[model samples]
Target: MKLEPVIGLEIHVQLKTKSKMFCGCSNRGEFEAPNATICPVCTGQPGVLPVINKEAIKMGVLASLALNCKINEHSKFDRKHYFYPDLPKGYQISQFDLPVGEKGFLEIDVPTKEGIRTARVGITRLHMEEDAAKNTHSDDKTATLVDYNRGGTPLAEIVSEPDIKSPQEAKIFLQELRKIMRYLGVSDADMEKGQLRCDANISMREYVEGAAPDENWAIQLNPKTEIKNINSFRAVERALEYEIARQTKHWEETGSPNTVQATRGWDDTKGVTTEQRTKEGSSDYRYFPEPDLPPMELVEIRDKQKEMLPELPRARKYRFMDQYGFSMADAEILTDDPYKAEYTERALSELVSWLLSLPEIEGTETEIWDNYGEKMAKLYSGWFINKLGGIMAQNAIDIRILKITPENFAEFITLVYENKISGPNALKLLELMIGAGGDPSQLLDEHDLGAMKEDKDEMDKIIEKVINEHQVAVSDYKAGKQTAIMFLIGQVMKESKGKANPETAKEMLIEKLEK
Candidate 1:
């Protein structure tokens, strides 16, 4: 019997504010020692009250608007009770029912066993919270320690509906969500640096053979289990796959009973999930409204944050096409990566429109063949997306480190248009000149690879000589042998030591022989 999986996600993103939620200490970057980014309030010292950071709210609200969430005009925080080594105050300050935003949805593409599918994941709540400290436990005197530097750091906890049926859906949702966050300046969402954390609960059930729960087709669900401590997208997908298989087997053997609702940690190397402990409910925390901080009224700030919302990817893609006349494929590639988009815009916007207008009016026989115009713009929007931009993003660096200056790349394209070089030769030169100073003239001279095909005067002499020497070729051409002229062009190029431009030589050869 086939089973169905119900999946929901809880994502915690540390906001990219300059300071802690309730203190003036910086929240980003590494600390020199344990508790380096701590203040009296962050360290949970007595007689200290929390001072809310205004910048954190700006980021959260901007992110909410980007996700299409309705911002809560009046929002307050509550205490979540927990006793752990990480919680120095014995509770975490979080928003319980009244969150900063609600009812947001992000659409994601998922690959199912059948085919690709798109799922709209609903955001139940996006609330503000203070982060807990890091804890390392060990048996030996050599190791285990706790770092409180991250404590009291502002974070946004986004809860999503159980609409994601598979791990592929979850992965794509997280990707799109991170893209939104980056565009909004909300958070870095860097998984490797632990700025973004994700947890998910999933359960599988069979299609209910009879009338179901609430008249909906209730797929009979098996005991659901959640895998915790998912730090990477690959891990999320692998752990969910492992959990689905393991849960299915356990149900078939044990007659399908509800496994205890406990949090489990995934062993990535072993590829198995082990039981950690029972999950806690909100009631278990014994929440109460935070008394020190007043409820925030966002009437004044709402409109401002609305203006700060970044254009979403799909919308930006259309704009790229409509405004720049870029192809859909090129626009999608460039806009998906933020740095590339910025680079393209910066390069294109700086150019004068008068320079661009020359490309069409100037005939191909004139300076239009020089690629003096449109070369830089084409590189910015079209070729740079996949070729240059992708390589930089993969290395986790900015566009500045991409080696070649924009001026040099423009020169290379110009050379290609001037028919000074062929496409293959241009690419070969680019590989050599990318990192260092790549002046087209210097490189062409050093490599002796420039197109000599356009020397019509010299190629004409060779073309005439070839026609005279090859009576068979001329006879063949007279007999309508098109291949005979091509043979003569090749002979001229070889005799000129490849300095004769092949294109010009071909035209001259065709003119003489065909005549």
Candidate 2:
């Protein structure tokens, strides 16, 4: 029988607030010594009342807005009963009935057989919670160690609906979620650092071979296997793919079993899922309102957070395409990182201002501003995404640490736009500006990398010298050999100490040689 995979994700994002969720302990425990940043509240000492971090709540609301979730004005915390070495209180304080946000959606582009298609994944809830401590077992399995430093860390648990149909879609959804969180400045969402973690609930069902089933039957889904604590997006995709095959085989052999849902852990090294325990239902947690802390009034907070939100990635991407005429692919690349997007915009703005201020020596100022947006978009995207981006990748330098200011980069681009420098010379000047942090024009002059002899008289003299030196090539060019003209142009550029613009020299050579 044909098979269809049903998948959803539960993502825990660590808020980048200064302190823990319910305690004042520092949240920078990832780099500190084991258990160095712990406190009584975090470690769940006797009779210590927990206070909510106002900043964490604000961040959560901001994240909710970014995810397109509806804010719950009165969300209360509940105690989730569980027993584990990582749990100090034997119960985690989280939201049950009332979460901060609900009914949101994230759209991701998936590579389908046809082409790239956009899939909108639904978010069920976005809840605030505290993280459990770390557990490490020894090599001999004789001793287990627990670190409480990460306990009580503020986390926003985003639960998605079963709208994800394939492993690839799931991965893209998570990646988009990470990008949104990062853009919001609420979370770094770095899986390697445990800032963002994912758990996937996946199952397989029959394709319903013939006639449409009844409403009740259509709503029926097979038993789901929850894969716990997948650290990376790729791992989530791999694990889900494996589970779909495994469950499909099992269903073929024994058919769908009506039993308890299973929770399994992914062994990334072995590339398999091991049964951890039966998945617990909501009733199993026995959640109730926390007696210590009162429910929050977040209506005003939500309004404030919505106002504080900067332009998100998707909106900014569409704006780039619509307003600046960037292609979808180019806009995606530019907006993938917040800093790079910001840099691109700043550089474009400065370039436009500079372009409009030009003396109109060659072109009309009206013409420059009329199509300046599209012109600047292409120019900035080409150089920044390809040329400068490639250089940074080769040198392993972060864009944030780049020495060239956006204004200086705009000026450098102007030099190229005006054909004041040759490509090779412009690249040389760019390297100097990036490395030494100086004005592009000044550096160009200091390095003598500009087109040599801007005066037409001087250029004509140099071209005449080249034509005289390469008489055979000049004669060949005059006899209708186009290749010989390029040869003469090369000689002129070399004689000009690599400063002669190839285009200018070629034009000058063609004029003199044709005459």
Candidate 3:
């Protein structure tokens, strides 16, 4: 019998706020000394009362709305009792029955062999909670150290339903979710820094070929193995894939699915999931409503957060495609980072305005945009995403600190579009501008890199020199070897020291060769 993997994810996002969730201690303690941000409330001293972070609550509401979750008007904290070194109070303050949001869905674009398809994954809940302290174990396995600096940090736990069918879908879902968080200014969602973490619950079920699972699929689901220690989205995908294969092999060997639910840890270096412990049910935590903290009234909070919502990634992506004529792939890359997206829009706006003001270009604003918007957009994206992006990567420059302003970038792109400078000279001018910002037109003149096309006499002299120097290629072109003209054009460009425009040189070479 063939088996299909059923998967769910538990994502914990560290909220970007001023202080810890229930205390006034600093929240920026990840890079600080151990226990530097700890206080009585966060470290669980005797008789310390917990106060909720209003900013954290506001961010939670914003994220919930972005995820299309229904916010609970009445929600309160609960005490989750579990004994661990990381838990100083012996219980964690989290939401139980009354979470901040629930019954939400996130749409992910899944790539298939044929094409891309949208898949909606159901969200079970997004609850507010406090993070545990950091734990460091000795290499000898004889001692363990706990750092309370990260303790009591605000966290939003997002639990997804078992709607994910494959590992690739799970990875895409996480990436989209992270983009939403970053767009909302809720969290950085950097997986390597532990700002965003994931745990996967996966199980294998026997299924018929070419048939969808029915409502009774849950009843038929074999006991799931909860895989933890998934530090990154790639790890989440790899762990789920490994667990599915392991469970499928067990089913084959034992003639039945594994009956016991368990927990496993992913060893990224080894590319394997090692058994950690048996999974615990909800009752094991002994959850109860906290007595100190009062229940929240969210009607006012929801309204305020809704007003503060910015344009999300998906909407921005569609707008880029419809308005700028950018392809889906290019739009996705452009909108992935909010800062980068804003920069692109501003630069494009400048370019469009400049294009419309040119005296030689004939047409109304709408007609001009319709005629040249796509062509200009393609040129801009190629230079921005491919050329400039590669240069930034090489020099370790973030878009935030980029020396080239959007206006300057727009000017540079216009230079390329108008062919004011040759392609090679344009690249050199761009690198110069990126290092020490300046106007593209002025820089072109300052560097003596203007295209030779405007100098018709000089271009004619260079073309004539190339035809005379490459007699064999000239003879080849005259004798019906039309491809030899490309060689002649290369000689013209080289003879002109990369100042000659290739198109003009090709036209001049063909004109002279035909004569």
Candidate 4:
């Protein structure tokens, strides 16, 4: 029978705030000691209370807005009861019935086995939660030590419906979500750094042949197993694929025995998942309101956040096309990286005003990458993203980090446009000037790489020497050989130590040979 897979994602996004969710402890990217950043409140000490971080709530709201979610005016936190070594309080403070955001949808275009498929992935809810402590298990697990430093770190959990029909679709949705978060600067979404985590609840369904039964065999969905701790994107894809097959095999083997609803651990090294324990439901945790913390009140910060909000990806793309005469393709490439796009806007400077005034320039700035003026547009775009970007990453460096400012680059472009410098020569000079910050005018003063004027008396002498030295090539030129000119040009460059104006050398040679 043909099979279909049903999938949903429960993604946890770590808020990039300076402190913990309910405490003032620092959340360092990397740390040196165990429980160094933890305090009485976050550690769940008796008689202590949690104070919600205002910034964390605002960050969550901004992400919710970006995802097209409805912000819940009133919401409360509930304790998710569980027992593990990492949990100091035997439960995690998380939202259950009412979350911070709800009823959102994000459209994603994913590729299936057949072709490109667009699906509206429904979001059930987005809630705020505190992270669990880190457990280090290795050669040095003396006394089962735990690092509470990461505990109470604010995390936004986005829950999606089981609209995904395959593992590939789930992965695509994840990647799209990651890119959106990065664009908004809301979170780094770096899975490797434990910034983002996801748990999937997948089941299989029939094609609904004949009629939809009260409950088909497939609809029973064998015990929705929870696969745990997938760290990488590829790992997410692999774990889901493994789980679906494992569960399907279990059902097919023993006449579809009723499988247990249990937790499973993913052994990434072995590429197999093993059952951990029975998965807990809502009542298992004994959730209730915390007396220490008040209901989170979102102060109307629209005025401030709206101002802090930079140009979003789509708006930036439109500006690139409407304002800069960039083709849609160019605009897309330019807007793909937020920092690079910001840099491009800075580089264009007042040229943006000129482009805005002209009708012809209006069509130039589009997000479509149709190769419209592909070469020239790409030159500037690539340099901003690729060349200069590496330099800026070290210590808040700028485009002038390469020693060639936008004005200097513009001046160099002017020289090439005026034909004062040849195209090939200008590129060569740019590479040097960008690194050594050398003067373009003085570049060939001692080098002799430019064209020699015929009006000069010294030009006649150099021409005489070149003609006498390259007799074989001279004979070939006179005999109607076209390549002979290139051969003689190489010779001139060699003898002049790359300091001869190739154009003048060619013209002088041709004139002298004709006589």
Best by TM-score: 3
Error of 3 at 293 (Å): 1.0
Looking at model 3, residue 14 earns an lDDT score of 100
Q: In model 1, what are the clashing residue pairs, if there are any?
A: 452-499, 452-500, 452-501, 453-500, 453-501, 454-501
Model 3: per-residue lDDT, tens digit, 101-185? 9999999888899898889899999999999999999999999999999999999999999989999999999999999999999
- Candidate order by lDDT, decreasing, is 3, 2, 1, 4
What tens digits encode model 1's per-residue C-alpha lDDT throughout 84-114? 8778888888998889899988876565688
At residue 514, candidate 2 shows an lDDT of 66
Local distance difference test values of all predictions, in order: 0.74, 0.86, 0.91, 0.71
TM-score of each: 0.78, 0.86, 0.94, 0.71
lDDT of 3 at 396: 95
Instruction: Rate residue 463 of model 4 by lDDT.
Output: 72
**Clashes within 3 Å, all models in order:** 6, 0, 0, 22
Q: Between candidates 2 and 4, which one is better according to TM-score?
A: 2
Tell me which of candidates 1 and 2 scores higher on TM-score: 2
Cα lDDT, model 1, residue 512: 74
- Give the distance in Å from residue 205's predicted Cα in candidate 1 to where it truly belongs: 2.0
lDDT, candidate 4, 1-515, per-residue tens: 54456778889999888898988999772564887888888888998878888888887877777667777777778888888888898889898877888898777666557965667888888888999998887786556678898899999999887777778878878877787777778788889998889888766554466654333433645456677888888887898999888767765775553356677888899998887888887788888875566776553743345456655675677677766567665676677666556656655662333334445444534422233334435556554454445445644654424576555554454344335654455556666676677565676454444543434567677778888988999999999998998988777756655545677778878888899
- The CA lDDT at 9 in model 3 is 94
